[model samples]
Target: MSRPILFFVIFITLLSCDKKENSVTDVQVLFEKVDSIQINYLGSPTVHDLDPLSQRVVFMEHSLSDSGHEIFIADFDGNILSSFIKDGDTRDTYGHIMAPLAIDGENSFMAYSFNGFIHYDFDGNLISRVKIVDFFNPGGRILGMGYGMEKWEGKYFYVNRGSKNADYGDKDFFDEYHTMYLLDPSTGIRESIIPFPENSLFMKGNFFFSRAWEPVFHISESKLYIVFGLEPVIYIYENQAPFNLISSIPIELPDYHYFKGSEKYNNEDVRFFGHRVTSGKISNIKYVDNYFVLSYFPGFDAADTEMSISTNTGPDFWNAMRKKYTTRIAILDSQGKVLNDFVPEGLSETSMKVKNGELWMMGKPNGEVELDYFQLFKVGLTTKGP
Candidate 1:
């Protein structure tokens, strides 16, 4: 090869690599500021869930009216595109169908407990229904449903199922031992990726009912990331037992920071929330990233209650009773070092998804009870020092 040709080839290769690097870096800086807020409802509007299909966002709203809860589709800017009141009683149903609206190719599908699963075309036309029984064995139950059509190397579409249990707690309840399954919707075949464990602690506990399992599973052509939350148990004693009386013992788990637990479980920190108390138990786990984001409600009880009163306390005593306020957010890196902490305003539900160097979040404003609005926020990540 000529000397000039060699130099030209090296220059081209270097430029190509720089372009690829710049592309990734640019995505991290693509975070959009809060341009506006759109309210989907005015009076007592309840947003059951939200899902992203194509570039559109689909959500369900439950309100008080002649018609019951209905599914509504809109754009990311909160422009209502389409809606229809579900026939019959669609209210009081379990599972968050809006989150996992699976877009299989051009068609979208959502699963419900009352009616197995419903499919719709790209234009939101009703397609066929797939019964839960047809896919599972007799006496099998529907665990949970999510919608999104993701394709790997093959022609198969993947859907997830949350395992079901008759003894599972009722509405406004949570089960600690929830299992997840990955299914091939095209063939109606399913395989368990996370199986339900026997004698799950979250199943039998009564002090604090478990909440819905918000299992995060994001898949790309080459990688898959799953995020799940777990709580630790804090035991309580009936009387002044030695274990309960110990204070400031300097107990330390290798990686975790122990905090106070509830009085129900023997009033001991042995169990943090509901599971065995340990530093390793409370940390969030992200796949292959070498780092995880640990999130917890600091001042809230296991029941998610913001306030409580003592039976022995009078009106005046109520004022004297110790109250705890919940801490908002804590961002930790792979080594469990606190990196950032911020109290997000009106943030009820927080979900983070990172793609192409950008962090996308679906955050509900004004807590989950009084607000039915969601805000999508983005933040760019750069190598530059914060």
Candidate 2:
């Protein structure tokens, strides 16, 4: 064959091979069974916070039968450690706890928009209360909700505050914004590490935002990683403008309809669905070694009375209408190159944590949501050889 024809044939062969590799659809669960536990609260557990250092988990319990909210603590194995009510019996009316119980070993911190921030010791003793001011100016335009707490070096602790304009829907209201702050755990003094910007479009929505909601952290002692949507951007300084763009990874999905089956109405006769597609609403992102994992939940449409009602329609109709998409975990390199893709079975509430030489995740088994239980699994990654 001529040189030009030989080159063309080789190019076609390589393209064919790439298509074949991408078309394969064998999904496998990577995590091995370690242990499982069930969390029981006095009422419905709305939000939970985990302290891996102390192996402690704290959650908020609100009684649907009554109008009260209580904070409870437990070990990782679900053993009840402590429980207390912050607001006596005044009824939190908010219906749910907005913040997680921030725990640092024996010390715990809880923040409520209406009640401000409260601190507690490991034994669930009230230590101090800091009334967060300055942000929420006159007319209460700023609402500071505690998102995540991290212990930096020495007594300098960091509390991430997400702010939203109080009057969100009105024409006179401005768009919501988010900012992070560094605080002295002992003196209760906080300095604005990152100031709140007006009309910041990082991440703002009812379901999820690419830049906002996701936790930004210092991946190493020096390097910080901030995940904005599918892209993970890094910054050298804690308070640096024009963040150095690190890497952007593209999230690959099988089909658009994979997330459309979960549409339904809730008990309140309110249609709860995503106006946009689920693939667009990226839920969680975590950094593991050199790779990053992104997880998303399908969006639902408006809810009607018959949203949860099931019919005896054949298995095919049920399968077509009630189908659920497998949670996708895309492994990417530091330069944002997709390394591999895998789908784990029985994965619910999928969140990532790094420990030892493996990637740890907490999720429930398939079809176990009806039972109100969840499980944790560990997956060993083979980085040396393919």
Candidate 3:
């Protein structure tokens, strides 16, 4: 395994289960900015997860001169408690830290890179490492690369897009392309579960859409919550061996538009299609406590995207889109019913995590402010009485 491959797989996955609330309560959701924290780092880091044990933020700062990737643990008051860099050339650094996993137990959290899973303490010391190949049966070969490793309720689940049963251009390609597996690290036993919904847009040979968008999912409370990009629907599943579908909730999004892929596009055309495309799509699906937070682009005009590319102003187009389109978040109850959906003010759509039962979001960047510190703010969600 290499760094980019692991990163892409991790990206695809960073890209949920909790309890039973069968009834949808009729209430309005409101977001209020509460407290804020700042970290004096300027590498455009991404917040991976909040460590429950230490209550510190686990984030990554990349492009650090020559160190490859660095993970940092910091307090809410902008204090960097500890940080470590994992270089592929280093002997025991797990061949470069690819992605950080949820905090494990009280002493440490887990991360995966090109080598395998690496355990590190709060002080950024390597506790142990397990190779990726060890997760399979001895002498048993896997046809495709195993990527997107997520830990849920003591077991590890990985998504493998390769299959011996189908090829890329086959009619059943998409079905085989999205196979997820459940693995027990203790026994090295793996079970295949969860495939792309048969009725998904990509299953009908819409490869362009798949190329342009990646699926976002979360497993919570022994259940799987996923929103395929370009599809404004949440698919809930029982996160067991068979991964049975529980419910499919269609989200009512305002100002949402999507591009339908044309079969005539080739590989090069797909790249161009993604660049000139303007569509409203779900960017992330996160499960927080009892509710789910969904981030989405509220649609952009194709003419505007085309003008930016044609006028040599492409560099400014993306930031303009972020300011104009503005990411909208939808709050759904445990049962996948929409409680409320609105654009949160002064919050960036980068990463949102729940801390102490409140949602924390990255502060949206204003052009006027120098990018010297990373700021996070707590957004309190309240329900209005029916």
Candidate 4:
């Protein structure tokens, strides 16, 4: 498989597990009295990203029709405001936007998926598109090959895997100039590169070698915060070039099995991130309600799950692993201290976002309403992330 496809496969495949049937399965009763607004999804919707911009915004593939996947904007009362992009036969149809990077206010947002930094308004109007250069080579010659990006102020932070998945065995591919780039959107030039740490975060596989799977970060005010996909620590920086490491707060995961199983599997010479991040498979983190709330998997035990992607398929111990680990949320204080960790009922596989003291989760509503795919539950947060 190609690199980006493999990245999504690892995320949607390996991490997804069969959920448990709960006694209080009703999403409404589990949280607040507010009724949920259900939005119909097209096709087998891939809820790529979500951001609360006045109304909740979603990027998903909801129908099997020629319309492909679309960007849906909805109000808090579940009213579907509009769907962006025209219908297309294939997913790669140009006008369509897929994954989202950052949402600037309710109108403009930035994303880097199809090898460019694209900006779009909520109405799907094209704002700006900058062709990203290949940072792996000197003088930045190539056109394609860019990963995730987040914009703080006018500078956009661009990151790459530094090495290609297909170039695994090539010695020359390891000599990457940089993995992280500080890009000036106006000039279309890389201002500088944030150097990698001397140590590695790799466990036992090559999966974590790419920036594609590293800590997903957010730019809050003047501070840029980072949370690793497999690590428990939250790193803070002074949102600028040469990102100065301010603090690293360790999230206290409750489950013992969840914590132990998240560490390095063995003494093999792993890559970079394997050694850096230990468990809790952090999926999403948002600054809401003056609190930095994060959602993460409790993580499957390495010994029992045999998590090496090269060796174990995701479904092999899917049930057992999912049963063993609990999907939980860690809420951080304004000063970034661990507030509390609990599993919010009915929070499904889709992305989670908090806005105006309300927590929104996306997923299909059980078995009956499968066609109405893009499901969402808005629960009033007894807390915030701002």
Model 3 lDDT tens row, 1-386: 01122211101100011111212245755566656777888766767666434667777765546647677888766788888776657666766443345466566777654566667788878788766653422211211011134577677665443333323344555666555556554443556666778776666675453333345667666778777667778888898767888888777655566665555445455334654356677877777757777888766666764564464656577777666766667777766666766666567764665444556677777767778887777666666756
Model 1: per-residue Cα lDDT over 1-67, one tens digit each: 0012221110111112343233221111112233222535544433332333344445554455565
Q: By summed lDDT, which 10 consecutive residues of candidate 2 come out lowest? A: 6-15
| Arranged by TM-score, best first | 3, 4, 2, 1
Which lDDT tens digits does candidate 4 get at residues 222-314?
Answer: 777776556566777788656777777776554423232222323244322343232456766766656777767665456643353334545
On TM-score, the leading prediction is: 3
For this target, which candidate reaches the highest lDDT against the unseen true structure? Answer: 3
Of 3 and 4, the candidate ahead on lDDT is: 3
Q: Say which prediction, candidate 1 or candidate 3, comes out ahead on TM-score.
A: 3
Tell me the whole-model lDDT of each prediction, alpha carbons only: 0.36, 0.41, 0.61, 0.49
Question: After superposition, which runs of candidate 2 have C-alpha atoms over 4 Å from their true positions?
Answer: 1-29, 32-47, 63-67, 89-97, 107-113, 135-147, 154-219, 229-279, 297-327, 353-360, 365-385
Of the candidates numbered 3 and 4, which has the greater TM-score value?
A: 3
TM-score of each: 0.52, 0.59, 0.75, 0.61
Model 1 CA RMSD to the hidden true structure, in angstroms: 14.8
| CA shift of 167, model 1, Å | 5.8
Query: What TM value does model 4 have?
Result: 0.61
Kindly list the per-residue Cα lDDT of model 2 for residues 1-386, writing each as its tens digit.
00122211101111123542464233321334343345554334543455545666666655544534666777767677787666554432222233444555545655533444556665657666654455342221211112344445533334344334343323322133333455554544555544222212332222222122333443344444544332233322332333333433344432322222122322232222222223333444456655555554432323311333335435674355334443455445555444544454444434554433335455544442454534344444444222
